[model samples]
Target: MTTIDKAPTVQSQRAGTGTRGTRILGTLTIVSMVWLIAFGLGFSPADRDQQEAVRIMYVHVPTIWIAYLAFVVTAVASGFYLFKKSLGWDRLAGASAEVGTVFVALTLIVGALWGRLTWGVFWQWDARLTTTALLFVTYVGYLAVRRLGGTHEQRARRSAVIGLLAVLLIPLVHWSVRLWRSLHQEATVLDPDGDIDMDGLMLFSLFVGVIAFTLFYVWLMLHRTRVMAMEDMMEDRGLDEALASRRREAAMPDSEEN
Candidate 1:
């Protein structure tokens, strides 16, 4: 196609394809989540030690991973928005941060539930738990900064700074088991050479859980970005209408003078 002919047509075609692709991915995500829950219920081997309680790890771990993914998106997108002044990047950063906070909350809840079973306590002041709690608080602070900022530029800069700083604490949380030798057990699957030590089916189900949760995150981010865009468009339309009304009012007096 000639360049002039391709412009609008190609753009619309790409938009249509992209929309379809997103819808398919979202459907797949829901299916995967359902499949994971079914597989975990039917196939995951009972933990010899913790018995059924260990099953929650599949949900808890994947949720925390989603939180990590969200923050990474937020930091990178915020940087791009600041440098390029792209609303696309800004909306991405905002969407990711909002979803990330929700995942963080879920992680804490599932973790506490898991702890109640395995640790014999609902919560603890130990190094690992404390550090994770601090990590949550830091993200909350980041969200607060974003909400309180005076302008888009101010929010983007402040949120990006906080996100970059908060990531330093994630490793601290992960390593707290070794750094302080607290009651928290060393990570079983993620530790170097630790081997999953889980049954093959259980591992498979958890893998599915991870995929499901990641897709869920993507879905939430997409929805959030679209909502933000609609809000922005509405605000712009409102402003334009107000300006047009003012101009009409101003012109009417001038017409009378003429």
Candidate 2:
């Protein structure tokens, strides 16, 4: 396992940070989530074409947005770890990737629901859908690699490299609709021509959903990182105890006489 001399310090610092900020963010995220649900489910007018199905967009789009953000953060952290060889960066990268996997999985589920409703099919091999699925699987593989048995540095280095390489798929996923004739629509709010093709209320609801999910990701990352740090500390203590026992045995006199 990768060892950090300051694992205890890192854990304590994160606990302190999580105390005040997590509470505030958690509360605010709940508030935003409530408003988003109300706006998406009741206030926002249904789409002329898809009607009730369009509401899924509020959930589906924001989740993918947050998932993308999570992967980007992971990649950046991994890059820093490579450059500075900081265990903290490696832990952050791993934590972010795990959270990103959850969000991306949710993204795929919600997207499938939306597709079934809007397109009369649960899935399609379109450019955007395929690339998004690929992105999800890639990060999932990254997480799996992190769990493999190895020294902390070995696992961290391998996972960090995978994390950075996986981000290359992000652009492909984002621009897949444009790059090919995908059933998925190209950017609506982020249209290159600076046009939003949705109602004002719907747009606001989408924004709230984005903020809520983003805050949720932040909370998840903080909690998950703390958990990883504690695990690392436990692993370190186990190794120390085992080594001490070995040293004690070596110091003991041989009992064989005769």
Candidate 3:
């Protein structure tokens, strides 16, 4: 028998292949994250001076890096969407921005915790922190803008512009410590002399954190993009049904009432 509930079932099946890939990647991400945390906590060497407090860098630095990476993907996707007027590009930008916002919040929270342990405060108006905060707020606003009601093209065009413009803060956040004297320390991994000023274990653990978080972000973006596509598909189905109903009504002859 025919069923009224078949449309979404078909949509879900269409997404099955990609979802399976995401599931496999998500499993690998979980395993890598566990290894990263274990190595950071137990194997990584403590700093010469910071002692136990240094471990936070494994999470703090990597999360902030991923946040930057996410937004950069969003900006590039936005640019491509603008150039091509493609829905695929718009979906990619939206997915990246959503994941980026979560990572930015994590960066702030972890940074605050690390600061309390090392800098003797949970919050500060340091240049890097302030700029990072601004970046977070900007992307949050970008996500909110996406939720505003509009036609697909209208929403995509507006969000693509926002995605491009919001990422301008990334460089400012990255170089804020260098640009202005602040309590935040300068870049460690990107030293001017190309010398990494850290123990081998610490560096290795940092690398692991970066890889793990980046994989997690990719898994998240895949899932988010799929969900967004499904939403759009459902909306399209609803519009199609509404238009077909209107057409049927228009085609009906007026009742033979004098």
Score every model by TM-score.
Answer: 0.75, 0.79, 0.79
Which residue pairs in candidate 2 collide? 1-151, 1-152, 2-152
Candidate no. 1 TM-score: 0.75
- Tens-digit per-residue lDDT, 25-93, candidate 1: 899998998898887777788877778886887898888889878988888877776678766677677
User: Any runs in candidate 3 off by more than 4 Å, and if so which?
Assistant: 1-18, 168-196, 239-258
Ranking by TM-score: 3, 2, 1
**lDDT score, candidate 2, position 231:** 80
lDDT accuracy of residue 241 in candidate 3: 74
- Give model 1's clash tally: 0
Q: How much lDDT does each candidate structure score? A: 0.71, 0.78, 0.78
lDDT-superior candidate, 1 or 3: 3
